[model samples]
Target: MSYSKPRNDYINAVIIPGYTYDSKILVTQCPLEETVVDFWTMVYDHNSSIVVLLDQLNRKTPLWLGRQEVLQFKDFTIVQDNSPNPEELKLILSHKEKDPMSITVFTTSKVNNDAILPSNVLLDLLKKVTECWKIQKGPITVVCSDGCSKSGIFVALKLILEKMKIDDEIDVFQVVRTMQVRRPEFFTEFDQYEYCYRCIKEYLENDSVYANL
Candidate 1:
């Protein structure tokens, strides 16, 4: 699917964390009302897409909006893994309809598990985002919700960008600010934010010099 020419106008890809559809309550809080025209245009013009990540907790299968019914919403490619392999994750990220202007939804088991949010997962997401940047003609927005879990994903994403040496290009503060605006209840704990920052800093400072265990 070919995307229309890119514009400076903000195009958002909302990420509602978890499997339960009840989480959609947060959508009402999004700045969609402020950017209604632009958001709708991106949707109708096929210039933007919504990428949602469903948590593994919900037994009920999640539903996505179809393209014909709406503007252009694609079903998320669920990544079901306790600890996914980097190459496998990369393959999954590459399965988009458009080469450069597509949004991806990544769902994981939990947010705070020290064992679950591995470097490989972060790397895969970063790779996808960078790939999007290379192909996308305009700025891409990633909107995440459901409190700290979504923040954790954002943290991991920032870490991956740092590892790839593109941290300067992407504004971490702006990303987090956007998340806060979307869901005021999100990132309630400062510790979670600190943890994410530490994780990214540690990875950047030591990963290159340290040998793999």
Candidate 2:
């Protein structure tokens, strides 16, 4: 539980083990208006500096405030910063009397619930997020509508890529299996599982992609 409202310890989120790194991936559902505070609290508590949003269903409003807009949630204040990329938003999370922290939110190609993104699109987003992770050195938060579809696929693919980078090989089965053990909703549909293979095949066909990972 994050250091937020007392007795509000429950949130639809999970920390998945990372490749050669424990607790490196934080996956959670999109925050409703009521749970938005809890969502930010989780991000700050975990010291996460990067958030990847995978879809926009029911997300008519942006989670982060607009430029120069301030949202005071309990003891935390979220202030927006100028962002160059329309898809990406930057914010400073300031806790009461504590040094403010910068967080970058990356929005991927819009995807529908329980649907899959093209392999190339997925790989491109992963490259960008991985680059940011190298600097932040903190867990990356993956968000989606229910926190399991696109979030799971991205995490599994990331681990597979990391494994390939370090060991020069890939094990889609083992990676997905390990993640599914933690949350059955991961790869909930058979098509989703096949989509992982599609991503792997795409990754292998492009030599330049290897360099980015």
Cα lDDT for residue 122, candidate 2:
82
Give the local distance difference test score of model 1. Answer: 0.38
Task: Identify the leading candidate in terms of lDDT.
Answer: 2
List candidate 1 stretches off by more than 4 Å: 1-46, 49-54, 57-61, 64-116, 137-148, 151-182, 206-213
Residue-wise C-alpha lDDT for candidate 2, range 88-144, written one tens digit per residue: 788999889677789988876556565667788888888888888877778899998
The candidate scoring highest on TM-score is: 2
Number of clashing pairs per prediction, in order: 1, 0
In model 2, the worst 10-residue window by lDDT is: 1-10
Model 1 over residues 30-139: C-alpha lDDT tens digits? 22333433433343344333322322322232222223222222322322233243222211111244333334333444433233355545444444444544444232
- What's the residue-level lDDT of 37 in candidate 2? 76
